[model samples]
Target chain A: MYEGVVQDLIDELGRLPGIGPKSAQRIAFHLLAADSTDVRRLAAVLVEVKDKVRFCRTCGNVAEGEQCRICSDTRRDLSKICVVEEPKDVVAIEKTREFRGRYHVLGGAISPIEGIGPDDLRVRELMTRLADGEVTELILATDPNLEGEATATYLARLVKPMGLRVTRLASGLPVGGDLEYADEVTLGRAFEGRRLLDV
Target chain B: MSLYRDEGVVLRTQKLGEADRIITLLTRANGRVRAVAKGVRRTKSKFGARLEPFTHADLQIYAGRSLDVVQQVETIASHGDAIAGDYGRYTAGTAMLETAERLTAEEKEPAVQQFLLLVGGLRTLAEGSHPPGLVLDSFLLRSLAVGGYAASFDDCARCGRVGPHPFFSVPAGGVVCASCRSAGAVTPAPETLGLLAALLTGDWAVADASDARHRREASGLTSAYLQWHLERGLRSLRLVERT
Candidate 1:
């Protein structure tokens, strides 16, 4: 371990999700060598973000106040709600510009191995959002992994009685990728979900 | 760096970096192997989907200093989609994968039996021929047997006395004779014990014909036996839909 505060900094950075010990040490040293003004700015922003940001009341997406930008925007279609595993997924879908509807961030998928289930996520909040019967369609854009699929299944079953048109995102070949190179599962899914060409 | 080829089932994966994952597989020849699959999270990755859990694949790996590197992956059977498509199968398959990983324990130590069991279990699960719970119980019991914790259903686990034991004990291994019965031994239905034996011996006709109540009882005993031997219960086991 290094001296007092420097070692503390490294330890704290190492606590982050993806930052390892080596990267933590490297980042700590880089911060020590960096300009004091830059360090202070970063520290201030960190504090400010924690103080200012909160989860949206309706959809559970990260927000500055009561609701996230999407939830608060009246222009977004209220008849549809896209369910995603995380807040970052909201940004990804927003980037696509194809989905004009609102979103419901589930925070995380149902991972039994990780001791996570439907109760651990914002599933209740999503159900409550659909309780008013305004939502005609619910798009499950959860990742195509085991946990994500489980989450989708759980949600679909829960909302089955409500009679909403629940749909899951398609899993298949990536755009601009070769068909032969595609994995059999993906190719099979593509075939299963095949669409006819427009005239 | 030496390159070796092996057929294996992907047991699980963990994120290593920005675009890489550490995949753990039970290979036919090399036992349990953990390898880094770099950039597999990228959209354009050559074989990202091929390395998912429940996929049996032929892999070309480059031995690295710490963890091996996956060079190329060819899909032998993609059971992931089939298993993941249903909730019951997904949870059951997850438990099977976890059990296989736990049984193998040591890396690159040629656990061919466990590997084959996993592949077969996955294939059967994907095909949806048998109930997911039955497949998982069979897989777990067989895996325990391969790991040297084979539970004796017919004879006493301790005294080796023959025929129709009354008490079932997890720590004592399986059904115990009246004289050999210890404290906390459960007296399960005779039918439950029969179902377990059928599951262990690959008597699918009997297993398929077993009653639901007996199946649940047998599953409970199987889980207890597995957990007692494994020391810790599998996380995904509780999530499996028995009904």
Candidate 2:
């Protein structure tokens, strides 16, 4: 059996996805042998993330103060809200550099088995934001899964009644995949939501 | 010893250190199961292809303290290929996988109803007979029912008073009367409740007759009901295309 603190590290690491007992032990040892300064910095950031960053009051995205950077940016289009499930998704969308609109992060998607309901998320906050009538088009950017679709549909129903246009992300099979490799369900969605190529 | 056989659908698979694979399955008799399928990464392995996601199979696994070892596998239905061929079903199936994993976390918990329902749902999806969205909604409603969170459409979800209830409360459970309705729950159209009941009971004749608006409304109800019970949101549900 492993020692107390080392075994504790292994136990904690094992709880993470894709990490098994062996990997957890390996990682624990590696971390134990790592430089003190490097380990201290990693530990410091973990604490800072919770202490410094907080959910935005207006849109629910992660923020340093009252509002997130995207929400406070005057250049961003406030009238169009791109709704998403997690704050991490805000980073993903910003990476594309395509959208310059405000965001509404739902914090989590609707998952019933875990007992996660619409009330558990910041959905009521979204309705409160829409009440101001500044948002016109609400882009649903949740994951391409059942829970995500459920959240998007729930959001659409809530927003459409308020007269905002709700649109979901178009479906397409991932790139670099062979036609033969593509599942018919995914291929069918690509056909149904087909786009006109500029080229 | 005799083969300890059980029915399951492969939830996911990942390559292990080298030639092995870690397969996650939601079994009928056993809840969620993880087993090592040795040398499955190699092309010559006999049952390697049997562990693909969405494929329903009967497995005989060697019980181990550290990790169960897959002894043999027999394909019950090769749904993965057919389901993967369509976009809507694929995305919907992914959500089903997450739901299945959440519903049955403990090993050998006798999730027979859930396993059977998923099998039927995947079979229906692969055949491309009913609308993919409707099929998924039915699966979601039934899955919740199997988990003991069945939503009432006709009777009051709170008082058991029978009548045409107008309000759908995810937190309050299901359909609610004017007396039982919370201050802020969204009231879906009457036709939406009918579609939901039909979907829950597998009365496709009623569900198939639903118009686009009714179907959409019913879907919203089902998804919300599901999320209310499943604490962590499904990672795949965001991809569902609304009609």
Candidate 2 ranges with C-alpha deviation above 4 Å: A1-199, B1-3
TM-score to true structure, per model: 0.95, 0.57
> lDDT of all the models against the reference?
0.90, 0.80
Candidate 1 residue-wise lDDT, B48-99, digit = tens: 8889888899999999999999999999998876777788888888899989
Task: Tell me how large the interface RMSD of candidate 2 is.
Answer: 9.4
Where in model 1 is the C-alpha error above 4 Å? none
lDDT tens readout by residue for model 2, A81-196: 89888888999889999999889898887654344667789888888888888888889998654456656766776676787788888766666656654544456668988878
Ten-residue segment with the worst summed lDDT in candidate 2 chain A? A177-186
Fnat across every predicted model, in order:
0.60, 0.00
TM-score of chain A of each: 0.96, 0.88
**Residue clash pairs of candidate 1:** none
Q: Which one wins on TM-score? A: 1
TM-score (second chain) of model 2: 0.94
